[model samples]
Target chain A: MRQSKLVGTLAVLPSFVIVAGFMAFPVMFAFYISFTKTNGLTYDWRGLDNYIAIFSDPIVHQVFLNNFKFLISVPLVIFSALVCSILLFEQFKGWKFFRVIFFLPNVLSVAVIGLIFRNAFGYDGAVNQFLGLFGNEPMQFFIDSNYSILIIILALVWSGFGYQSLLLLAGLTSINPAVFEAAAIDGAGWWRRLWSITLPNIRKVLGFVFIINILYTFASLFGFVFVITAGGPGYETTTIDFLVYLRAFSSNNLGSGAALAVLLFFFIGLLTLLQNRVFKLQKDD
Target chain B: MSDSISSRLTPRAKWPIFIGMCLVAATIIYPLFFVVVTSLRSNVDYKRDPFGLPVDWTVTNYIELWDEYGVGRAFLNSLFVSTSAVAVILILATLAGYALAKLPVFGSKFFTATFVSVMLLPGPVLIIPIYLVLARLGIVGDYSGLILVYVATGLPFAIFFLTLTFRAIPDELLEAARVDGAGFFRTLWSIVGPMGASGIATLAVLQFLGTWNELIFALILVPDAQMRLLTPTLATIGKRFVSDQPLTSAGLFISALVPLLLLTFASKYIMRGLQVGLSR
Candidate 1:
């Protein structure tokens, strides 16, 4: 037993070293940096000024609102993913082809997708031309600040739905067919079966996917906003991550950026904790 | 009764949903298709009808990208970085996973939990800190710096999946190897390694995809035009040369082709890896 214990310690040591040296240290260092007036290269302690400035900055407030917009869209995306997964889960001839097509966008880099859509939605672009067929004028997707966030949200949903569908499909497939057969025998209709049988069985996976999709979407809003719009048209779509980047790189306010990072960490952490509670509740039920 | 209910759902209901799905699919597929079509068209033809299918199919965009823009070099740079990063991730994750799974190490549970916690942290949160560290190490603008960061970022989830797979391996196999007088390394190499091939391959493909598709770190860390990865290069092309539609589309399509082909070939493994990586 002692020998096994020693072996286990030895086995896990490399991972421990790497994680500690890289991940843990950086995280703690970042937290520490939040309190200083560092310009990323130089470290000078500045107490609560960074945190205070962040709370007072108008752009920071805009970023918070943008993040809230992103957070609000999560449930809508999840619902769409759930509904589509159910629709696609049934046995059909072209199911695999549809699956491949749906999943195509997920594999491509978000940067490329941003570029493709940016051009596609430009004033003289295809989307406008297509809308011209219906007598509507071309709408500025990338340039118009009012519509920029919506475009990002749409692109995110389009790129993401496939993976969620796949997860739900896998969860659906794992349910014993006999249970469904029994449901059918008992005269449980399609909706009834979906609610009472399928939904209940896949709830755990649903909760997992929900938490992941929300967290990932929250984190990734910055990337899309960066690549597609660059928080353009007067910082309309500037998310917390974008703000952090601006603070650190553009404004040379590393302290403020670190404070923003800490706030983002807590917001995401709280959401994740709620998600875990939901998962635990489902497991218990 | 169930069949009747499903069937009796109004034809209008079915039609609207079907049409909606088709519209969504068309919207998603249109940009990708436009890129391919525009890439094949001459500049004049592209400007005339960027949405239309190419009237004259030509490899000029691809040829020009190679000859003029040096996208081929960018492609090679991305491939090298992604491959090296994936290789390191797989080796380190495997060894670490084996240790975590098989050994009764001190604070093993704590270490595993810590790794999981790090994985949940947003990538942007780590950027400034990591950037500072890389600068200090004199690797801020270096390819190795980017690869190291990718490997580190990817290791947590890779380790997580591999640990699960390793744990699933029957303990009796290890006991049998020990009975044959094989030591720990010998048992791990000879016994556990072969059995975990699928899991290893799955993790490798995932790490490859993640590192290959990553753009943010590549953009920030490697500002030199020559060393930029495919994603950043494509972004730059779009941002800087918006007028060069055909060439930019060609570049975008070229960047996407490899991942598309890989997914087509290893869809099963990718799916399994994603399920395990995300679900657990």
Candidate 2:
């Protein structure tokens, strides 16, 4: 009996070790290092000086603000995805074909999507050429700071919409068709049936989507910003993640980078907490 | 707000919605079209007529990207890393998943909870410290280092997923194997493993996709040209060929082809996996 127990324990040990070493330990270690000045080799305790540096740093402010700006797209994505899923729910002809086509971008690498968007929005690129047909002059999309950030957000929406829709479609499909039919029998219109029945049924899924979307907007925009803008226009497009990369690697300031990362961790934690509270309130209601 | 179900469900009024959806679909797929068409054209031809079919229809850009630009090496590197990651994850996650789901291991609930919490650890937050860990172990810029990171990143979800999968197996099958005197490993290998084949395949595809398109870790860990994966290598290529649209397009298309093909063939499994990941 003890021998079998040993084997069972041994079975889980490998994965536990890897996750503990690489994931759990670093999280704790990063928190520790954030309080100290470290440069790969040595460390000196600074006692919140690194955190102080983050507050005082204007660039960090810009990064934070840029991330908040990016959050604007969360609602936009959820709404658009909801609409697409509803359209797909109607079972229109070629609906499956459209679903697959929409999801094509999600399958492609983000690096490739970023690259494609950069090329497509170049001054003499396809978009401008299309605009030129209606007599619009070629505009520099990536050169301007505002336009640069706009392009990054647009690229994310384009790449992400399909996956989000598929997820919502799954949610929508899980709702019993009988409810809709009953609403129809009760003389409810499409919008009424959707609002009073379908929406309520998928509330859990929507909440989950909201939380994941927040997490995604906060961190996963790195690939798009990395390839398309490289946080260009003098760091106008730099996000917290991008700035952390720049501070730690590019500027070789490990302490500052760790501090910034800790701050991002806190931001995500707070967002998660907020999501929980919001959902809890809804559940109570 | 009218009650006539047929009025709403009839195909006549749905054309506009359908057409609108087709346009949305076009927007999603248009960039791919642009890239492919641009890839077949020279820089000058693309610049001259961005929307038009390639006048030149040149294969030179692809040849250059593959041979001279070393994207071919990056492709091989990505394949090697993803395949290696998938192999490691499959073994480790299977063992851990089976043990957690079926075996009467101590603190199984605690271990499963730890794995689930680990999934919430954001990728960016680990960049600094994981770099430090890799450096400490002297695996910096090494393929093994990147593969290790990939396995760690993929484990939490894979294990969580496979635990659910393995738990769904009728306990009777496992009990039957034990009645036949099958050992722990034997029962897992002979009884539980084959039963979870689809689950395993789903995990493999998802893990493969994760490591294949993983950029930040590859960018941070493997700096050497020979060791770089596809996405990070493409980023480097993106920087170098900022103005060379045609060449970069070819590189992007090449990077996209594998995952696109995988999605095309196994989309049902992929979507099913995603539904499990998200909704569960």
Candidate 3:
């Protein structure tokens, strides 16, 4: 029995070392470093200064607002995914092929997706070429602030709706077909059935997608911003991650960068707690 | 939207849904088609008519990209890092996840919570101290450093996934193997490995795609031009070749190739893996 316990310890030791070193430790260190100003590996304790600066900074304010603005993608993604999933759930014809192709973008590299989106909407790209057929000039999509954010959302929807739809499809699959059939027998139209049977049944899945999309909008916008706008025209579309990259590494301002990061950590932590709570409340899946 | 009732609907009702789906599929396919066509064309041909079918189709961009540009090296680096990390992830996650699931390991519950909670840590910010830690260890420029980071980050999902997968395996099989004089490693190798093959394969495919597509960590950890990965190379070379669409598209095609191949081949596992993650 003692030897078996020892063997179990040996088995788990490698994973424990890596996780503790990389993930667990850094989180605690992020809190520690956030409080102090640093220069050239020299640290000076400056309590709350870093936080106050970022809070008061207008650029940081705009970046947070940009994140909130990007939250608009959540509903757009859900609505698009919901409609597609419902349609696909119908399994009309070619649904299998469509399902496969739809999942492709979800697995694609962000760098590649960002490039494709950039090219598709670039001044000399396809959208412009189509617009040119009507004698209109090519439009600059990335350089402008409003258009840049819009394009990112469009790209997110393009890449994400498929995955979310499949999730909804999974949810829709679990829902006993009898419910839909019974609703139909009771004179429910498609919309009526969807609202009463479909939507209500899939709320848990919807909530999951909703929270993840929100988390994604916060955590994973870096590649798009880095590749497409480069946070351009003047930090207009810069996401928190991109800003952290800039503030922490590029400008060599680790102190305040770490400060903003700690704030982001708490924000994401709060959101995840909320997600856990939602799931706990639902307690279904 | 189930079978018995939908089967009663006339074929006429299917048209709108069919066309709408086709339109959605087109949104995905058309752009990719344009990318493939553009990559195969000469820059001048692409330049002369961005919308036209290629009059001068050639693999020159791909050939030149491999032979002259640093893409070949980046490709190799990406392959090595992704494969190495996936291998490590499989070994580590399997052993740990197996223990957590099947063994009377001490602190199993605590270990599980520690790993899972790490998943929710904000990545963009989390990279900072991770970078600092790697730098502190002076492994920032080492392939081992980047590989370790990938393995560490990927373990949570892989372990969590495998835990669920392993929990489904009946204990009687393992007990029988043990009763037949099989030790822990032997049972794990002959029994658990084969039994859990599909789930493990699903994890490998998912992790490989993830590591291949990763950008920021590779960018930050391995900054040397000689050691860069594919996605970050795209960012760097993307800036350098903004005007040369064919060459840039060729780079895009190269970086996107493996995951596309994985998607094409292991799409069953990919689909299963993705749908399964919703339970988390």
Candidate 4:
């Protein structure tokens, strides 16, 4: 037994070492740095001041709200993906072709997607040309903060739905054909069979997709906002990540950035736990 | 009555999917077609007809981008970084996953929990600290630093999928190899690795995709122009050519081509691989 234990420890040693050296230690170091008013390598301990400044700053409040805005948009995008998946789930001619095309945006880098949309929404852009048909003046999509956020949301949905649709398609495929056949034999219509059979069976996968999508969407806010707007028009779309980048790099306020990082960590952690609980209950049911 | 209702609904019910598929296809394909057309059009023509098909197809945009924008260097850099990161991730994740799945690893639960928890930590959360660490090591703004960060970031999901794949391999196969007098490494080499080839390939594609498309870490960690990857190069093009519609469109399409080709060729494996990662 002791020999087995030794062998087991030996087996896991490399992974443990790597994770400790890289992820865990850096996380703890960042947390420690949050309490200090140091600029990068300089060490000047200031307890609670960094945290206090975050709460007092109006910019931080705006960033916190922007982060929530990004988070809340996930469900809307996921819902569209769900509907798309349902439509694409059935067997049809050109199904595979359509699948590839829809998933194309997901494969492209977010930076590239942002660039494409940035041009599409610019003055003298394709979107303006389309709107010109209806006799409306060309509106500045990027200049207006509200429209900028909306444009980002649309891009997010476009890039995001493909992957989620693919996931849901997988989930849908896994459902037993006989169940649907049986529902039909019992005189159930398409909506009835779908409501009674498909939704419940795929609920677990849907929940998992929701959690992953939410986290991914939140993580990606920086790239899109950075590439397109740079949180412009007076920081209207400045998310937590962009704000941290601004504070740390732009303004050289490392201490405040670290504090914001810590808060962002806890916020994401709380959402993850909540998602886990929701998934767990669904699984148990 | 139920049979009659079912028969009546079958034809009409398919319309929703038909409409949905059409909408999804248009949304995805229109932008792709737009990019391609714009890339082939002259700058003047592009400005005149931003939404129209090119009257004369040409490769000038691509040629100019390659010659002027340092796209070739960025492409090579992206290739180098992605391939190196995927190679490292595969080796480490495979060994770790096999050990966890097959061997009696002590505190395996804790290790699994640790890796999964790392997934919960958002990518942006690590940017500042990782940058600081790389700066301390004096490797910031270099390829090696970016590669290291990419490997670390890709490790968790790679291991997660590999562990599942390893666990699915039959214990009887390992026992059979052992009965033939093969040692652990020999059994792993001769038996386990071949059996897990498909899984490994899937993971490799995923690791490659994730690293190739990663922009945030690449942007933050590598400040030098020569070291910038393809995504950042595209971002630079956007910054430089804010009004140059054709050039921007060409750059976007050029940057997307590699990943698009990678996906098209290995799409089956890519889809399977993504399913594994996302499911976990």
Ranking by DockQ: 3, 2, 4, 1
Q: List model 1 lDDT by residue over A88-107, tens digit each.
A: 66644356666767777888
**Ranking of all candidate structures by their TM-score, best first:** 3, 2, 4, 1
Give TM-scores for every candidate, taking all chains together and pairing residue i with residue i. 0.92, 0.95, 0.97, 0.93
Docking class of 4: medium
**lDDT by residue for model 3 over A79-197, one digit each (tens)?**
99999999988888789889999898988888899888887788767788788889998888877899999989988998999999999999888888777677777887877887888
lDDT digits (tens) for residues A35-91 of candidate 2: 888888988899999988789988888888888888878888888889998888887
- TM-score of candidate 3's chain B against its reference? 0.96
| Interface DockQ of each model | 0.52, 0.66, 0.68, 0.53
Mind giving the per-residue lDDT tens digits that candidate 4 earns over A125-173? 7888789878989888877888888888888888988878888888888
How high is the lDDT of residue B35 in model 4? 82
Clashing pairs in 1: A8-B103, A8-B104, A8-B105, A9-B105
**TM-score of chain B, candidates 1 onward in order:** 0.89, 0.95, 0.96, 0.93
What tens-digit string does per-residue lDDT give for candidate 1 at B1-280?
1333332234454665566666767867877887888778787887676666777888898998777776888899999999999988887887788888887677777988888888877877888888888889999889989988887788889889999999999989888888899987788788888999989988887788788889888988998987778888888777776666777788889989988888889887887786785555
Candidate that beats the other on TM-score, 3 or 4, i.e. the better one: 3
Q: Which candidate ranks first by TM-score, i.e. highest?
A: 3
* Model 1 regions more than 4 Å off: A1-4, A133-139, A282-285, B1-27
lDDT of each model, Cα atoms only?
Answer: 0.79, 0.85, 0.87, 0.81
TM-score of model number 1, chain B? 0.89
